[model samples]
Target: MSYRAVLRTPHALRTFLAALVGRLSYGVVFVSLTVAITVATGSYAVAGGAIALFGLGGVLVAPLRAGLVDRYGPRRVLPPLAVTYAGLLAGLAATTWRPGTPGWVLIVLAAVAGAAAPPLGPVMRAMWSQLLPDEAGRQRAFALDTVVEELLFVTGPLVAGLCIAAGAPAAGVALAAALVLTGTLAMVSSPVARAWPRVEAGAVVAVRVNRARLEPVLVASGLGLGLGALGLLIVAFATERDQTAAVAWIEAALAAGSAVGGIAYGARTWAASQRTQLALLVVALAGVLAVAGLAPGVAALAAAAALAGLFVAPTLTIAYLLADRSVPAAARTRAGTWVNTAFNAGSSGGSAAVGLLISRAPLPVCFAAAAIPLLLSAVLPALHERVDQQVEADPGAEHDDDRLEHLAGEAAG
Candidate 1:
């Protein structure tokens, strides 16, 4: 596979592995914080709110953080942030561990830690374009990244679960903190990472990109992710009846499906446009997830979840691929951050909105509510494809107008 060649590149393996470890926290911190807080306070409400604040921290920081990575590069920007990120995680652990700590303290600490979230994913993904510029190689690299992300999604909760079981939820949080610190240091020190320019000086450079062409796919994919978040909430509701044991299995199944899909999708390139594939997969997910809410047992729910997950990694890979291909190198970091921030906002909003609805509505209704966004997601791509086709069809129209103008000039002469 081209991926093998990609890894053979200088410093590729080291950078990729470090990135995998660091980005694992993408899924871990939320699980660790939520579980640990719930265990301490015996309140899911507080746990949920705390986790949301953490995400909000990232959302608030993404644009600025991305710009820094772009201007100064990861080596210069990440090391300090890595130290700060680990410190914040440690602080959160310490603050939340106290028995009588005010709830507000935990919330504030979570936000601060989240704002300090590492930029490993963005930097690493950006590096892939530089590392493997070919279409095949780049797609394979993205697929590998997506698969690792799926593993993180599955393993995050499992690791946290084991830590919580062995000690308390704080153990999980502490472990995650250590991973971030270790992984961040490793990533920044990698040869490729260190080789990146420290910073570009003089007036700040900004590149104007034509988003008119890319917006539809971006919106469609973003909404698809948001709907995926809605499905996650439905799964939460499915497990609400104290089916704690089943929750892990269901989540595992979902993660597994995404991993499998990514591997399979990356095995061969298809002729279809990325937008077409993205739209189709997301539309398919809408139906599967709506039915998933009606699953009669844990086993059934697990199967449904897996089916819903089948589309996730591929969709994300395409979205990431599009982001890389669409934006100029100068805007790479900002573009990556834009995609992430948008997706996070969508996912968090979906979960928050569904969390509110879950208490009052039937599980099926909540699941169906999630599907509504997916359906809307389908519309964006469809329109995008039509626009693309129209553009293709009228390619010569402008040239013809130019020809007419030339003839008019000749006649005037």
Candidate 2:
């Protein structure tokens, strides 16, 4: 779980670089698309709406797409999707270049483009879990991945910013498209990514309706809801303060702080006792809410947002770790999809709710709204542990220990 582990392990290094390339492309596409839309339509609302549509499209498509990944493997789904996503970006750019394009046309294009985007986060996570081959390694890998994601987000927008400054925001989108197409094709071709066989469609079809199989997904849905609220509050604050132009800066600072926190988490050898990580989550959440509520201008908000993000990444990282342990191997990708879908849906809903709040009251009201989820995250760990212990201690839990050992071994490999 230390830098030395990443330093010494060739598999981890290869897997990480591959994952990082895919992620960088994803970030670049988002920034480029948003900036392009804003400039082309001459409306910030249009750009915001396009981004929102993207989120909604992902939520709608991800669960089904995940089922495909589980059935056909990420190898089959990811590469073609990357190529199609690139084409879509190119099409979007073309649409913008034409004069007198209708807003509705842009909207439809955005919606379709959003739906076409790859599920890089889930795919990379699954790869990391497989690459590391043990619980400790998985934990460290997740922490490292979290940090990498933060860094990617920070840099993605900078690239977009530079592209926009160059008088052709399409440059970023074009570059993103190329990166995604190349990276996905190359990564999916790797021996590591192709290790698992595709699940039989019949088996996946039968399991689709099993409610018993969806418990972890449901819980993660709740977590995603809380985060969605946080996203809304941030948007409201950024928009109301006329800091829309600096949105990337704010995001970069927040991500930078989260990366720092995750690096600290990853650098350690022993896992922080679940109890300690939970306590830190609570303290961090409280600090985030307090800072957001203060509304001490952009600088203060930036610092607070970063502080809030510090714990946010670690909390989710732990959740994914628990998920890896809980779900059956055959169901891993599907289960991971559910967790991601829940997060997307929750964030969308949270944003909608806070947008309403912002319409009614001052910006600080958004922060107050963020507090509810932070408080819930603070409490969720204890409840989650108890439920987990109960399941583990059940007398009828046949082969549970052996299964855990096997899973740990898989992670360690």
TM-scores, all candidates, are 0.86, 0.81
Query: Worst lDDT window (10 residues) for model 1?
Result: 399-408
Candidate 1 lDDT over 244-338, as tens digits, reads: 66766787788788888888887788888877887797788788877777877778888987887788788777778877777767567677667
Local distance difference test values of all predictions, in order: 0.74, 0.68
TM-score of 2: 0.81
Model 2 score (lDDT): 0.68
After TM-score superposition, the amount by which residue 233's alpha carbon in candidate 2 deviates from its true location, in angstroms, is: 4.7
Candidate 2 wrong stretches, greater than 4 Å? 43-49, 197-202, 205-251, 269-283, 295-300, 362-365, 377-380, 387-413
- How many Å off is the CA of 309 in candidate 2? 2.6
How displaced is residue 81 in candidate 1, in Å?
A: 0.9
**Candidate 1: what lDDT?**
0.74
Candidate 1 to truth, TM? 0.86
Residues 189-248 of candidate 2 have per-residue lDDT tens digits of 767677855566567533453322343444455456555666666666677688876556
